[model samples]
Target: MNKSLAASVSPALYSSKTNTKIFTLTSAEHNIEVGNWKIDSTQLGILDTYFIIEQKILHGGKQEGSKIITLTSPNGLTITLSPTRGMSIINVIGQDMRFGWDSPVKEIVNPAFINLESRSGAGWLEGFNEMMVRCGFEWAGHPGLENGEMRTLHGKIGNTPASEVEIEINETAPYEIKIRGLIKESTFKKAELQTLAELSYTPGTHHFTIHDSLTNHADYPRDYQIMYHSNFSKPLLEKDAQFVAPIKEISPFNDYAQKGLSDWSAYLGPTKDFDEMVFNIVPFSKTDGSTIAALHNKDGSKGAAIEFNVKELPYLTLWKNTDTEKQGYVTGIEPGTNYAYAASIEREQGRIRQVKPGKTVHFKIKYSALMNKEAVNKVKKEITDIQGNQKTTIIQKPIAKE
Candidate 1:
């Protein structure tokens, strides 16, 4: 694959692969004093049996970009960082995941893919997340030609620049980490900001905010094709899970969306009843937590929940696995300004964020578990007032525009 293809998919935000290695990512005397938080890159490097981020550190794929970052836990959970740089996980110790996949066999050789016995606790992804504050994807494809069966990706990391990464820890508290990054091309050089933020869960009470500062560094003019790729396991999709946003429609990921990242001309059916999955940038009816996006399993034993204000994330990309030949465990619940191959659309509409040589751009995202109807009603009332009985266009829920 080309460099742009690799970099574009660097962080495998919604990947389903297996790796087993644990690298020691020790903590430093960090003193950013961002807030009451602990930044322990070492502990952060540890993963549960539940999930892992696809960093593309091992088993090469096509050269997607300059670097790639991935995370995985013993519990069969994974978050990939190709397009983005970081991820934030919550309440991990409670799930039983597939460990046989990420663990190594004692062949007693230097396995390129991953080695759990040599590294820390199979948390190389997290350690790498803090090792340096910058990197990109390089190559991506199947694990190997003859013997390798795993489809993997690879990239260069923090080795890109020199900047201080902060990690602080407090007993029974939410941990916070921060890193600074940059991207420079021929006529542009802009700073890329990222953070792994977490707030103590309060069941259905508290909300968490994620922030980033994206700058366009081109000397002349530039356009930023920004996308937020969020990943969660299949078990999270509960019967109550719904999608709500300011979307116009959803395009399916048929042969078109796959071959070209921006292709969305075809509308594939909901992947095996996974209606929350879409390929096009669909319209959402989210006023303040509208159910425009969803993933529910009616069975109700295992499920996922989501509640976000559409004002921040206007576009979304819902991905699910339907190929009988493929097997994976997670789906993508992405909220962003651009979808695959849809960057030019935002640029043409002047929605693209541009940055000059020393400029900065800031954006924020907040997520939390929703309460009962009363809480949703309260939010709805506030948003309703904000929208106010307007005789405006009424776009279909999660449907695309003409």
Candidate 2:
């Protein structure tokens, strides 16, 4: 990563009658608004087309010695990734609108905070406010033996580091930006698992796509688990927001969620000491083989949606923790290859997926910000079409505000 910025020259157009400096930097990662360019006293052809990619090194904290990648497109989309943190997406900004949550800890911390020593993924939970990836080998739950190894919270994939990274920018006909990386987890003489992950965005679209290939190089078949822990907060997850999904059934994971079932699709303002709730969802299969989840803001004017292949990632986990303004006021719409349960439990239930030796599995997921009423309505109609005439059960309203 370059520690200092390099100067760039501006394009110049000199006419016998008029002179103007048209500043333009091509194929550069960072740009400075030096000044506006004018041609023939007319503001006719000024366009910003190139996407920017820059690296920043943090200092004086747990994030010290860490490298973070920031991808910015001309369409007002900004994504930040921490390579040291399993290439986890820490933040996302679309159309000058914040889509993901922000944690109390503003800087990236050490991966040790979520190491094996800290059981139950409590360490990972402490800093769990991002578009994070979870549970690769030994999922965190049940705390039982997994092939003679203990299980802990979700898994350690989010804490794992990437071994290789490649960034590609296409400025030609089809303008797009791509980030590809590899994360590996293995034992000295045991299992070896790797995931090739790619995130891509094209110009003129307010969306991005994630494609992952999980491979096992072990001599024997290896069980693996993964979940896309994508979260939404604040402006996007406002008080009157609604959760829409084409799910066959919704099971409350705990009493709190069971009690709030009536308003399960609705959101509330951040309240003090609000109990965190989890809901397990079984998505309905479609001929197109895709599933979606959307959150429409208070007035239903705008929203955001995520789509994934139900065949590859079968489970969905909806997490709500509107505890407080500063502590946690966000919700997560997670899609996983397996239910986030004890490895032994999922294996016993035959929910665990296996990658045969020398074989690979692939998953494709997309996320888009719905910028208008029509976009929000389009997603709602899709969900309804999938559900058909199945009567969705409606329960009691949420606990009334004091």
lDDT (Cα, tens digit) per residue for candidate 2, span 201-261: 7755788898888888889988777778888886778777899998787767656678877
| Per-residue accuracy of model 1 over 1-402 as CA lDDT, tens digit each | 111112222121212222212221211222211211222224445322122222222222322222333333232232222222233221222243111111111111112333322222222232222211211211111122223322122112212221222212221213221222222222213323322222222111233344554443334434343444444443343223333333354444344334423422222222453322346454444445443333323332332334444554466666553322123234455555554332333334444444455454444554433324444445444434443554324222422221
The list of candidate 2 runs beyond 4 A from truth reads 1-48, 112-114, 119-121, 137-148, 391-402
Which stretches of model 1 miss by more than 4 angstroms? Answer: 1-163, 169-209, 217-220, 237-248, 251-277, 282-294, 305-312, 324-326, 342-351, 367-402
The lDDT per prediction is: 0.32, 0.69
Error of 1 at 38 (Å): 11
Candidate 2 clashes: the total is 5
The TM-scores of all predictions, comma-separated, are 0.44, 0.82
- Predict model 1's lDDT versus the native: 0.32
lDDT score, candidate 1, position 399: 28
